[model samples]
Structure formats: C-alpha cells, structure tokens
Target: MEWTAAPARLATASADFEADFAACLHWSAETDAAIEQRVADILADVQARGDAAVLEYTERFDGLPADSVAALELSQAELKAAFDALPPAQRDALQAAAHRVRKYHEAQKKASGESWSYRDEDGTLLGQKVTPLDRVGIYVPGGKAAYPSSVLMNAIPAHVAGVQDIVMVVPTPRGEKNPLVLAAAYVAGVSRAFTLGGAQAVAALAYGTATVPKVDKITGPGNAYVASAKKRVFGTVGIDMIAGPSEILVLADGTTPPDWVAMDLFSQAEHDELAQSILLCPDAAYIDAVQREIDRLLPTMPRAEIIAKSLSGRGALILTRDMEEACAISNRIAPEHLEVSSRDPHRWEPLLRHAGAIFLGAYTSESLGDYCAGPNHVLPTSGTARFSSPLGVYDFQKRSSLIEVSEQGAQTLGAIASVLAHGEGLQAHARAAEMRLKG
Candidate 1:
C-alpha cells in the first residue's frame, strides 16, 4: 500500500554509505539463550529416555498421536504410493526437478568426490580416499510448509555420493503429512523416514534411539529450536552449517528492466522477516525506476506484508559510483544470492569474489536456482560465503588421508620425522620413526 514501504535510498556520494551499509548487513547469528537451554534440556531428555521422550515430544509439539516412534515410521511402499498418487503434472514436475538435481550432483561427484592416489619415485603412495557418510539425517521443516525441493537438494547429493542410509525426518504437525514431500523421498531414494521433528529428531539422529538409528551427520534447515539443537549436538554428530537469514545482493548496471530487478529483490525478501535484499547501481534514474516498480508491484504479492517488513528492515537501494564499486561492496557483504543484472554479467562476475550462488543476467532468476536449477539450493547464508560454500556432494562425503610408505620411502621419511618429533619434545614419536628406519 505504501510506495516507500520497501527500503530507504542511499548513495555512495553521501558520507554515511559505509555506516548505513554496515547497519543493513548486521545480523547476529547467536541463538536466544532461552532457546539454547531448552534445546539442551530436550537433547538430554532424548538421549537419556530414548524412544519414550521422542514420542512424548512428537505428541506435544506436532499434536500427532502415536503410541510408539516405530509406529510413526513410513514404509518404502507408503513412500512409493505417495509418489504414484500425485497428479500427472505435479509428479512430472517433481521428477524433472529431482532428475536435474541428481544429474548435477553426479557430475559433482566425478569432479570432486572420487578418490585418487599417486606413487612417488621412492614408491610412497600419497592420496586422499573419499567416502560417503554411512548414515545421515535430513531434517525437513513441516510446521510452516513442506519443501519437496529441499528433499531433492539434500538427499540427491548424498545418494549420488553413495550414502547407504538416507534417513529423513519431517514433523507431521496435527497428524498431517504432505504427499509431495513423501513422493520426493521416494524419488530421492530415502532409506527411512519418521514423522518426528525438532530437538528430539536431531537428538535421535545424533545420539540414536531404539527406533531411530544415529546418523553420521545431519543436514537441512529448520526453525530456531532446530538450529539450537543442531549446535548443541554438533561434536556428538556432524552438522552441515548454522546458517543465518536468507540474503540477496543485486549489482545492477541499469541495462535490465526495472520491474525485473524489483521482483529479483522481492524473491529473497519474501523468505522471512530477517531475510535481506539490496540493490546497487550507478544509474540514479534506473534506481528510482526500480523503486517505483517495487511500490507498484508490492501489493500484488501474496506475501506482501512479509516482503514489506523484510525490505524495510534490512533491504537497501544503494547508488554506487560504478559497477566495479558495487562488486566491491558485494564482496564485503558476501550475500547468499548475488545477481549480476547487467547486459553482460560476465564482465562484472570476474570482479565479484564472494557469494554463495551467483545468478547471471536479467533472465536468470534466483527463483530458478532455488527450484529447478541444477545447482544445490542449500547455500551458506549471511556472510558465511566468505569462508563457507554451497551444500554439494562434498558436504555429504568425507575424505581420509592415505599414506603408504615403501621400504625405501620409509628410510627417507623416517629421518625427517625423527628430527621433527625430537625438536617438538615428542620422544615416543621420534622412536616410532627410528624403529621404521633400516639399521
């Protein structure tokens, strides 16, 4: 309803651009202290009481009546039935999305998931052995909505990497289950699924229960409670990453249509209250045009209030000196989604350095990457893109260092190891190397 309801306008020429941008980018990833303590209590309860606690929490939170956690398990036949029952168009779309996701991860496996070794002149074998996780629990959020795409994104990579057991946990609040999610599980080759969620589900995956097996790692995003639970159970079981709010940064060159850029910003803004959306452009006239378009289109969106809140809370329309300056600012933010909405995206892409996933050109919408795009949609949020990465086959697969020293190779390595170990005051380590040396 309000034209200026989106974000405030800022220009690099102003003295406060740096300060204003910093304020926009600030997002504390810390969980609420109360949530942390509550999660701790739930994890302890689950670990100590096992299936009983799981069932209690399931009933309390999800309002699902179940005598036992075992009863909540969905069979392979049930999953397949859900898939088969879908309307032709929906089923076809799900399959198409899954197929693209699978194809991309399969290529990723070949590129970075294979094991390799090289023998040295002295016959020393040095390499890395790549192996998929034995079992992993994927927590799909159900309280708000079902994400069939999430099922494809998380499970397809693990399946492609040869993970034997892909256990999925989805909260069936009020005894309701989304058939699309189950169908995705079937198509993605999930080994087991449980109608359980929250701290109990994560604890079951981390510590194991009578009905639920402990997983090697846990992946997927959830609410505050789930994020807190994941953090607490980390060392006991591996976790993907503690992601922050969704974000999008657009570096526009004023060539793309203003409406296209406005909708691009809205794509992330609608995700949640904390989600951020920003646009940087050198053309002041075009920035104004995009702002007008955002106002004109805001009321039409189903999630208008949310978009308005997110845009007003964290979004920005910044006018930079040039595209290069915009790219530099983008690096500093390291957004989850970066769109190069220019006539020639490649020209500015090389200037950009840090982003979870980059959407090039005006036609390549960030929405495509979230759904049908071959790339994994699970990406580092907030500024984690500076050091972290998009969830890929690498996240589901781990590596072990391989070292096999030949008899002659041992002589060469042993001498070096002995001196280094002695210098470090580790006598046993020195002697162990000495023992391997030929007399």
Candidate 2:
C-alpha cells in the first residue's frame, strides 16, 4: 500500500498559528480509566496472593504457564550463554554500547554521586552521604519489538551507581525469548532476570512475590498496563517516570539537507502513531523540500504506515520567523528529543533549555542518542523535561544529609531551637533544646 505524509504547515506570522500549533502539539497522556482500574486490581491481587497471582497472570497474559514465579527466572549462566552464542557483530555491538554507557555513567557518578562533608568554625559537620539503591527492577519491553539497548540504558547506570542487584523483567509473550536482550542483560551486569512482563510483572517487582524480591525502585518503559501499575506503585517504590509517546522536535536553519531533516523526523514517527515529529524552520522553500522528501522516502520504510499516521495526526512543519523564534518555540514545547539541525547548532543550543536530550548539528541523529551515544535514552516526556531529567546514575542513588554538632555548636543551636520550638507551642521540644543550652 502506498503511504502518504503531510504534516501540518504553519507560519509564525499567521494569525491562526497559535491554534494550529496547539492542535499539532496536543497529545493527552491520561491513562484510560479502564486500564487504571484493571491495573489497581492486578497490583492488589499480586500484593495479596504473591507468587500464585503472578503465575496465573503470566499464563493468562503471556501464554506462558509457570508452575511458580521461580520457573520464570532466567539464570546467570543462561544470560552468559545468550551472549556467547551471539554473532560476532551482535556481540561486538552490545559490548561496545555497554562500554560507552558504563563509561558515561561512571563519569556522571564521579561528578555527583559521592559523599562529602565540611566542618564549620563551631566544629559542626554538615554534608551529604550519597548511596546507591540496594536493589532496582528494570522493565524492558518485549512485546512488538525487542530492545537490547533498553537493557543497556536502564541497567548500566544502576550498575555504575553501585546497585548490588539489578533485577530485570522482560515480558516474553508465548515463552519466546530474545537472545539479544538476554545478551544485553549479561553485558549490562543485570544481577537477576525473569522472562515475565506486563502489569503482573510490575506488580511482582513493586510488591515482592514469594519468589520475586521487592525492588527499591523500578525503571524502564512498558505498555499501558505497565505504566498504570507504575503509577499505582509509586508510593510503595520509586519509578523512573510515567513516560508518554515519543517525540522529536527539529529546529532547522535550512542549512541541512531536506532529505536529512525528513529522515530525522521519520526516526521518531515510526515509534507509534501517537509519536510526534515536528520541524521548525524559517525557510518556506526548505519546508516544502522536506515535505517532498518525506513523501518520496516514507513509502520505502518498513513501518511506513505508522510513520504516515503519526505525521498526519500529530506532526508539524512550522515556519518560524528565524532561528531565535524557533528556539523559543522548542523551549515552549519542551519536547522529549530536540535536534538543532543547523550550521551553528551550538549558537542555538544555549538558547534551548527544556528538551530531554539535545542533538546538536545535523549529523547527531536522535537514534544515536537512543542507542549508543553514552547519555541515557530514558528521558522525561510530555513536557516533563521542563522540570525533570533523563534516567542516570542519580536515579539509582539517593542522598542523606549528615550533621554532627559539638558542645560549642549545640550551645548556640539550642538557644535558637528553644525560641522556635516555643513559638510553635511545642513545650517538650523547647524544654529538650533548653536542657542542652549552657546555663
């Protein structure tokens, strides 16, 4: 079947540009009410019945009937075997990606993930103690496609952060396992893995089954059920973020080839129908050329239908006043992935402040960042990038403030504490502080 791609075209100077832009950018992140309720029930059932519930759900959903959750577990030897069995190219790629991801995360840890202390003149020591999570569960999607990269991106950072146990859960529908995924688990240093998935898998991770150990946090993306389960389990355990549909926004200066920009847009549109890919450029002729390239190149894609639907529904080709205006608009959108496809990408990059990851210059494709560019691929979506960040070593570690007071410090601190405690009408707190004050 022939596929067509026609993204909405808008000029910033047009009076209706605001309305057109809003319509193109709109995507509701609200989970379906039915899915939410179903997820709640699944979480409750798993919390109550533990392994039995997990086994039943795995059979019903994944078509893999396990006698127990233990039956679903993937052993270290199996992971190693998967790695050893891979073709040399696959093995080399996996190891190389893991190495770069590990290196980047190690650098990230050294910069921020550490314990520090400082002493004041009064001999009061104050600082922070940084520590890694004891255990974390990373969910890898194994439904439509297998992502070995997800395994590396999620687990490597945790490993670098010193997480002792990285429990991996990948839903293998019909008991079919992806060797690449298993190989990635081995390469990324996953401590434990299970051929399980869906909200049931999430429930097992969030609330410990008899066999599945409860994790301190859960990271990685999944389908609706997995997302809903994560939302329900947030208080019980930490979650990376509630991700939305993938997005890529290109701020073009018309210097890059139209075909390059068109393919860059296609890179994200193929993710799903809801995924968005937009181009903001000042040159109307370049925008026209890009649209022509999109039309010419889209039909050649294997996922051409999906790209067509995504571009027709949510994508845009906005003609901005200039690069400055394009940068401002990109910040307003705060897209998941932003590409400055321009001659002087660095000049515009500083002006852009709110994307999950910025790919500077035409050559830096978003796909590179998604796979092996070192920085994490799991990023905040749906304008969440405005405040949050990409998944990194920090996500797998926590910090605690350290304080130690000497006699001299307490003497001064106690008097101040006594006044504040009394002001709040807490006599016990006031007396406690007053008791420590020098007479």
Candidate 3:
C-alpha cells in the first residue's frame, strides 16, 4: 500500500486561519470514563490489599505470574549483570549518556538547588535549606518500547540531588525485561527495581505496599492508565506534571535543509498517532519543499504508517507573514520541543518564549536532546509548556525557609504579625506574636 503524509496547510492571511488553527491545535486531555473508573478501582484495591493486589494486577495485565512481589524484584546484582552483559557499544553509550546527565544535573544543583541566606541590618537571618526527598519512584514506560534514556533522565538527577533511595518501576510484559533499562538502573543508582506497571504500580508507589516503599514523589511517563493514576494520587504523594502527546514546532527562515526539518517532524510523529509536528516559515517555497520531502521520505521510514496517521491527523505546515509572526504563533502554541532552524537562531530565540525545550541551531536536532544533549527529555507536553518546566534536579529536592530572628528583629516582626493577626480576628495568633514582642 502506498502511504502519504500531508500536514494541513494554512496561510496567516487566510480568512479562516483563526478557526482552522484553533481546530488544528485542539486536543482533549481527558481520559475515557471507563479508564478513569478502572484506574480508581485499581488504586483502591492496591491501597487496601497491598502486595497481593499488586501481584494479581501484574499477573493479569502483564501476564507475568509471580508468586510474590519479592519474586518480581530485580536485585542490584541482576542489574549489574544486565549492564555487563551488554554489547561493548551499548555499554559505552549508556555510560556516556549517564555521565552527561549527571554532570548537567550536578551543575543544575549548584545553580538553583543550593541553599542561600542573607542578613539584614537588624541582624535577622533569612535563608533556605535545600534537601532531597527521602525516596522517589520513577516509572519508565516498558509496554510499547523500553526507554533506557528515561531511566538515565529520571534516576541520575535524583542521585545527583543526594536522594538516598530511588525506586524504579518498569513494566516487563510476560517477564521480558529490557536489558538496557536494567543496565541504566544499575548505572544511575536505583536503590530498588521492580517489574511492575499500570495503575497498580502507581498505587504501590504512592500508597506504599508491604514490599514497595511509598515514594515522596513519582516521576516519569506512562500510558493513559498511569497518567490518570498520577492525577488521582496527587495529594497522597507529589507527582510530576501530567504530560500530553509529544509535540514539535519548527520556526524556520528557509535557511536549514528541508529534509532535516521533515525528518525532525517525523521524529515526533512516529511516537504515536496523536503526536503533533508542525512547521512555520515565511517562505512559501520552503514550506512546499518540506512537504515534498515529507512525502518522498515517508515510504522509507519503518514507522511510516504511524507517521502518516499522526501528520494527517494533527500536523500543520503553516505559512506565516514573516518570521516574527511565526515566533508569535509558536509562543501561543508553547510546543514541547521548539526548533529554531535558522542561520541566526539566537535572533529569533529571544522572540520565542514558552517552550519545554528549544533546539537553538540547525545542527541541534530534537533527537539529540532526547538522548545525550545533557538536558532532560521528560518535558511538559501539549500546551502545558506555557507554565510547566522539564524535570530537573530541582524536582528531586525540597526547600525549607530558614529565619533566625534576633531579639531586636523579633520586636519589629512581632508588632507587624500582631496587627495582622488581630485584624484577622484571631486572638490566639495575636497573643502568640505579642508574647514575642518586647515591652
């Protein structure tokens, strides 16, 4: 069968541009009611029954029958063996990626993850105390594909942030464990590893089982069931943002090769049918070249069918009035990955804001960032990039405000606190402040 992938074409000056553009960007984040109900039932059952529920769900969903949860656990020695058994090239690549990730996060920790303090003239010391969570659970998607990159991205940062315990959960269908994932866990310092998935794994992480210890936060991507489970278990344990489909919006000035941009779009489109890939350029000729390349190259791709469906369904190749207009539209979209494919990327970069990650040059493909670019690939998807951030060292750490009020400082602060407390009609709060005040 012949396959074709044609994105919706639009011009900024068209009369129906606004309506069409909004329609193109529309994606409901809502999960099916049945999935939500199922996830709720699973969460409740796991929370109530603990290890037995997890074991049952693991067997039922994954077809990996386990007599006990302990039988499902992957020991440190097993993880190390997985790493050692890898081919020389695979081992080198995994170690290299882990090194870069660790270095980047260590630098991140130094920049914003560190504690700081300041002393006022009145001798009041105000500061912040930075500390890592006791433990964290990272859920790596193992159903459709195994992502060793995710293992590195999620666990390395927690390790760098001084998190004492990092629990990793990956779904291994029929007890088929991905060696690379296990190797990554070994390299990234996961304290515990489990072959568990779906809402049951999330419940075990969030609520804590007799075997799987509860985590302070759960971070990583998953299917609909996992996303819904994370949303439901938010207050019980902190969670990273609920991500949506992958997205890539390229802002081009017709300088970069059209084939490069086409392949970049394909990189995201191949993820799933719902993933979005878009191109915004002022040059009409360049837009045509990209579409031509996309059609010419689609047949050569192994995942061509998936790419075709994704591009046909959600992709767009928009022709803007100018690069500035493209930048404006990109900001509105707040894409998960924004590629500034231009000669002077920096010029347009300052104009662009609200992207999960920006690929700043022609040589910098979004895929590089996904693998070994020394940055987090676990980014905010859909349009959530407008307010959310990529997972980082800061995500693994918490802060406590430190205020040391001197006798002189207490008097001034006490007076202000007493007035505010009294104004709010809380006599007990007012009295508490008054007690600290100097007569």
Candidate 4:
C-alpha cells in the first residue's frame, strides 16, 4: 500500500494573503434567523412563565418528561455518590485532572485588593478595585457526550476568581443526569447543578426562574441555539463569548509521523461536520503522506463518516515552501487549536501569533489540551483567536475604578471637567461641576 507523494514546488505567492484569509469569514455568518426566532420565543416563554415554561420547553425540545425544576438541583450527597460509583481508575483520573485544572486556574486568579492611588497636589486620589462576580452560571453540554472536562474548565476558573456562588446548567436528555458530569461538578466546587440546558437555560440564567436563580454572568459552551440566545441576552446578563464551530490547524514538518498528524486532525473533525481540520506542511511529501494516513485511519475510526465529510469539505492539506510560510498561513487561519509538530516547536512559537490554544511538539497532542493539559478547552473558535481569548478566571470577574478627592482637588479637577463638558455642549454637566469647583 504505497502512497503516491508529490514533490515540493514553489507556487506564485500573493500579496493579498489578508484578503485571502478574510475569505474564511464567509463561513461564519450562516446563522439561521428562523432558528434564532424559535429560540427567542422559547426563551421569552421561559422568562415569563418561569418553571412551568422551562419544563414544557425541555419536554417539547429534548423529548423528556417535564419534571420539577427543583429536581434539577443535585445535592452534595448525590454528587458524592456519583463520585463513589465511578471505577477506581476513572475516579483517580478525574481527581488528577481536577487538581491540575484547579492549580492552573488558581494561578490565573486576579488579586482583588490590588489598588493603585495617584494623589494630586490638592490630595485627589484615583484607583481601581478588582472584584469577582457575585454569582456565575456555567453551561455544560449533556446527553450523549458527558464533558466532565467542560465542568472542570468552566467551574474551576469561577471558583478561583472567588465567585460566591457557581450555578451549573446541563441538559438532561429524557430527564436523566450523567453521573460523571454530576461528580465532576462536585469535585470542581460548583454551588449548584441543574438539569436544564439550551436557549431556555441561558434565559433562566439571564433572567431568574422560580427554581434557578439568575447569575451575574454566564460562562460555558453550547449549541447554535444556546449561542444565539447568549448573544440576544448579552446586556441583561454578561456572557463569555458567542462560540462558533471548532477548528484545528496543524503545522507539521517531514520529520513528524504522518499517522500521528492524521489522528490529531481527526480529533477536531469528529467534533462536528462544521469543525475544520487542516494541515500545513512545508514538505509536499509529508502533506501527501498525511492525506493518505487520514484515508487509512478514517475507515478504522468510530466517527469515520463525520471525519471524512469534514476533511473533504472544510479540511485542507496546504503546501508551503518553508516553515516560515507555514507559520504565516497559520497566523491567517488563527485556528482554535494549532499544533506545531515541527522539530523545533519553541523556535517557531514566537513567530506563531494567532491560535486559540497551541499544542507544541509531537508529544503534545490537542487531546491533552482538550482534556487534562491545565488550560481551558473552552477556547474561541471560527478564527476568533484573532481578537478573543480562551476561557479564564478573568472572564468571571469585573473591575471597578476608585476615586477619592479632597475639596481642593475637586476644585482643580472640576474646572477641567467643566471646560470639557462645556466644549461638548453639555451645559448641565458643566454647571454641576462648576458648582463643585466654586464651592
């Protein structure tokens, strides 16, 4: 089974790589307005009718019986029981992953008391106070897939940021909770766990329900409907970001094993059909080998059809003349997961600027970052790494500026403020400051 390989050839380079890169934006805004409208109606109903509407919608959409919303709440004892039910190895793994995630997020926590004061000649002082949100809601996707990792990633950060209460919402398909998810919630120190999910869950978190209390901010990932609902409820309740389809871009040299790269590419593709998996290699032979390896491995994989469709439609084997070219292309894609399977990953790390989360070297697979590798897996997708960030403790906290001024300082500062206000045609503002200055 010899694979046909192509030799490296330098193609004509284009100056408008940015425009070429900009073309990818066309893939994102395919948001279904009709779906959004339906989700909006459901959210409105849940907000207005409270627990009854939530139960009705959960049943209608999730094909489950409408149980009491109170039943959604998992007790500490129940969580502990779930933990105890797990096999010894599975329990140990969860504990180890939780510890690693907690340590990483603990380091990311901001010092709340941090303050800087600058006094004017008149004894005016100005500073800022960092504070954590009073309460936060974390949405964990449930049903067929149990993401204990999502639980760890979202809750640990909020905990580290000193969020007083962390409420988690997970969809219980057919009105049943995944024991693993519940156990992980307990281990991650979540204050409460609810079996609600989807757009209604987001609404419940945004606008309080009779059973589920409203939170200051909501952080976690969900389906398209949930993402749209979050976008709609932004000001009403703070949200992390509107996540898009998952993506991964691998920059591999000829030195790396093609099978390893192929498996890594499939890792992201199996997430969904919309998920993008690409490979950028300088050596054309390596590119061809990886493509062949993908074909070889696809038939053996559990999600072969999904990966094949994803690879054929969204994935690519981009050929580059050198590692520098590969890096430049990667910066353009700004993939959610970027793997540098090159001989010298550190040497190229500085040159590689845009990626949601980077996996360096052949040994570090994207799966590590997804599961136990100490970084938040709930990262920005659909090239959002260009401007956004992966979920962290900072996302769950807020900062407020502090100012203290003496009478003399107010006189001095108010004069300047009054002038600026007057220039802006704000007479009332000017008069208010003028009165302070005159006093």
True-structure RMSD, every candidate: 1.3, 0.8, 0.9, 3.4
TM-score, predicted candidate 3 vs. hidden true structure: 0.99
Q: Model 2 — TM-score against the truth?
A: 0.99
Write down the TM-score of every candidate. Answer: 0.98, 0.99, 0.99, 0.91
For residues 185-221, what per-residue lDDT tens digits would candidate 1 score against the true structure? 9999999999999999999999999999999999999
Most accurate candidate by lDDT: 3
lDDT of 2 by residue, 1-439 (tens): 8989888989999999999888888888889999999899998999999999888899999899878788899999999999999999999988998999999999999999999999989999999999999999999999799999999999999999999999999999999999999999999999999988999899999889889999999999998899999988999999999999999999999999999999999999999999999999999999999999999999899999999999999999999998899999999999999999999898988899999999999899999999999999999999999999999999999999999998899999999998999999999999988887787
In terms of lDDT, the poorest run of 10 residues in model 1 is 1-10
**TM-score computed on alpha carbons, candidate 1:** 0.98
Candidate 4 lDDT, 138-171, residue by residue in tens = 9998776879899999999888888989999999
Higher-scoring candidate on TM-score, 1 or 3: 3
Which is superior by TM-score, 1 or 2? 2
How many residue pairs clash (N, CA or C atoms closer than 3 angstroms) in each of the candidate models, in the order given?
Answer: 0, 0, 0, 0
lDDT of each: 0.92, 0.94, 0.95, 0.83
Model 4, C-alpha of 26: deviation from truth (Å): 4.5
Over 69-110, each residue of candidate 3 has an lDDT whose tens digit, in order, gives 999899999999999999999999999999999999999999
